[model samples]
Target chain A: MNVYLMIAVCSAVTLVPRILPLFVRTLDSLPKTIRKCMLLLPIAALGCLIFPLSLTDFSSSWYAGLVGVVAAFLSSYFRRPMIISIIISLVLTTLMLVLFP
Target chain B: MNVRRKSKAFQVLFAVAGECEFDENLIYSIAKHSHFWKNLHGKGIVLMQESTLCAKDGMKDGFPIFLGYFTTALAFGLLTRTSGLTLVQGVLISLTNYAGSGQFLMMNLYNAGSFLFEIALSVFFINSRYIFMSASLYPHLIDKKSVVKRILIGFGVTDENFAVSSLKGKMLPFPYMMGLIFTAYSGWVSGTFIGFVAGNFLPPVVQKASVITVYAMFASLLGGEVRRNAKALLVLLVSGLSNSVFILLVGIPTGFSFLLSMLLATAFACFIYTDEEVFGV
Candidate 1:
C-alpha cells in the first residue's frame, strides 16, 4: 500500500469513531449496561494489548524479558510514573541481555 | 518466538500511548490574547467564574506525558526505520494518524506484506476502544462548541486527552483540549523525526537494546492499570492467556486471536465486574 494511502485510511478509521459521537448527542440514551460496558472497555482492551505479544517474546533471552516484566510490574504497581517504570524495565532487560548474551 | 509474532511495535504503541492527558496553561494564555477572549469576557464576570477565560494555569499537566511521548515516538521512529520505512513515512504516520497503535499496526502489517483490507481491519479492531471512549466522554463535554470546533476536538481525542479531561470532570473547553493535543502531537512528530535522523548514528549495541523498549512500555502500562483497578489484573491475565493459547496452541491468526480474546475478556468483565467494583473506589 502507498504509505500516504495507508496513513489516510488509518486516520479516517480512527477519526470516524472519535468524531462521530460529537455529532450524535443521543449517546446518553444508550442502555445502562451498554454504558457500563463502555466504561469497562479500557481495562479489557488494555489487557488484550500487552499479553502473549509483549511479555513473552524474548528471542535472544527469555530471562531478560522476564526480569523486565517483573521490574515493570513492580514499579508500575507501586504507582511510579509510566516513563520511570518503563526505564527501569528497559535497564534491567538490557543488563540481562548484556550479561547473558 | 516467530518473527511475525514478535510485533512489539503494535503492542507497545497501544500500551503506553493509550491513556494520557496534560494541563492547558499554554492554550489559556493564547486564548486570553486572542479575539476570542473578548467574547469570553463579554458573557460574564470572567474572574468570578470557576473556569475563567484567562485561566493561564495547568501548563505543567502535560509535561510529564510529553517526555513519555517523546521517548516512545522516538523509539517508534527508530523501529520504523529498522522496519524498512523511510523517515517521511514514519513522520507522516505520527502527524496524520496521531494514533500510536494504529500507526504501529499499519507499519507491521505493511512489512508483513498483508493486504490493505487486512491492515484496515486489524487497525479498526485495535482502535475500537476509541468509540467507547468518545461515547463515555460525550456527556462531559460543554454544549456550546460549534460543529466545526467539536469536530476538531474530536480528532484530537486520543486516549491521553480523554483520560485527562475525564479526570478533570467537567465540560472541556475547546481551547484546552486543543492545547493538550497539540502539545502531544508535536512531541510525537518531532520525536519521530529526531529518531529517524539519529537512528543510524546509535551504536549497534544501543540499537539492539532499543527493541526492548516496546515490551518495557507494555508491562509498565499494564502495571499501572492493574494497580488502579485490581480486577483489571484478572482482565489482563484472562485476555493475555487466552490470546497466547489461541495464537500459539490453536494456531489462530493474530488478528482473529486478538479480537476474540478482547471480545471475550470485555464481555466477561462486563458480566462479572460492576462499574463500582472495577472503576469505582
Candidate 2:
C-alpha cells in the first residue's frame, strides 16, 4: 500500500471507534453486559502489548522496561496520580539506560 | 403625613423580613429533597456520585495522560523509519495506523517478507479485540447523535482513552471525549513526525532503546488493570504460557502466535469462570 494512503486509511479506521461517541446521543443507555466486556478490553490489549516485550532478548531496552514496570506499579499502588506514575516510570527508565550504559 | 411615612417604612421592613424567611425555607427544603444531600445518606448513591465526579475529573485530566501515548507514537515512528519507512510513511502510520500493536506487528512482518495473507490475518487478529471493546462502549455512547459524529469519535477509542473513559463509570459527554481524543491524536501524529525526523540523527542503539517506551507504558496500563481485576492475573498467566508454548512448538508466525494466545486465554477465562454474572457476555 502507498504509505500515505495506508496511514490515512489506517488512521481513519482506528479513529472510527475512538470517535464513535461524538455522534451518539447517549452512551449510558447501552446494555450493561456490553459495558462490562468493554471494561476488560484494555487489560487484554495491554497484555498483548507487553507480552512481546517480555519475550525480546535481554538488552538495555528490556531492563528499562523492567524499571518502568516496577516504578509504575509502585506509584499506582500508592494511589499516586497517573501523571506522576508515568513521569516516575519514564524518568526511572531513562536513568536506568544512562546508568547501565 | 407622619403616620403615612411610618406605614411606608413598616411595609418596607415587612417585605425584607418576608424575603429572608422565604430564602431560608427554600434552602431547608432543598437540603431535604436534593439528590446531593440525599446521596450523603445512601451508600449506593454516594458511590455513584463519587464515580460520576471521578469521570468528570478524568475527562478534564486526560490531556496529560495522553502525553505518554504521544511518546509511544514517537517510538513507533522511530522504529518504522529505521525499518525502511520514509518520513511521510511514518507520519501516515501514526495518523492512519493508530493501532500501536498492529502497526508494530506489520512493520516486523514487513521486514520478514511475510505473505499478504499472513499480514492481513495478523492485523485482523490483533485488532479483533476492538470488536469487544467497541461492543462494550456502544451503550455508553450517544446512539441518537448524527452518524458522522459517532463514526468520528469511535475512531479515537484506543486502549488509553478507553481505559481512562471507562474508569469514569459514566458515559462521558461527547465534547469532553473529543477533547481527550483530539489531544491524544495530535500527540501521536506529532510524536511520529518528530521521531522520524530525529531518527536519522540518533545511533542505532539509541533508536532501539526508544522502543522500550511503548513497553513501559503498556506495562503500566496492564499493571493497573491487573490490580483491579484478579481475573486478569489468570489471563496474563495463560497468555504468557500460551505464547511461549506456541513459539517453542508450533513455530507459527509471530502475529498469529499472539492471536492464538489471546483467543486461548479468553476462551479459558470464559469456560473456567462460568458465573455469567461475573464474566458477562
- Share of native C-alpha contacts between chains A and B (below 8 angstroms) recovered by candidate 2: 0.26
> Who wins the DockQ comparison?
1
lDDT of 2: 0.54
lDDT of 1: 0.62
| Model 1 stretches astray by more than 4 angstroms | A55-57, B1-51, B54-65, B100-119, B132-146, B165-173, B279-281
Could you tell me which 10 consecutive residues in candidate 1 chain A have the lowest summed lDDT? A51-60
Q: DockQ for each candidate?
A: 0.47, 0.33
Model 2 docking category: acceptable
Error of 2 at B176 (Å): 5.6
lDDT (Cα, tens digit) per residue for candidate 1, span B182-261: 77677888988997888889776556665556556566666766665677678887887897798778987666666678
DockQ of 1: 0.47
Go through the candidates in order and give each one's C-alpha lDDT: 0.62, 0.54
Q: Which one is best on lDDT? A: 1
Candidate 2 per-residue C-alpha lDDT over A1-101 given as tens digits, one digit per residue, 9 for 90 to 100: 45554445445445544454344335424553443333343345445445544435334356666667667656654545444555576577667677786
After superposition, which runs of candidate 2 have C-alpha atoms over 4 Å from their true positions?
A1-42, A45-54, A57-101, B1-62, B65-68, B99-145, B159-180, B200-203, B271-281
- Candidate 2 residue-wise lDDT, B1-281, digit = tens: 23432453343223213211111112211212222322333454333222233334544545554565566566677777767888877776766766776686666555545555556655655554454445445544443256766665577666555544443434456666677667767877888888788778976555545555455545554554555456766776787667767665677766566667766665655544434423322
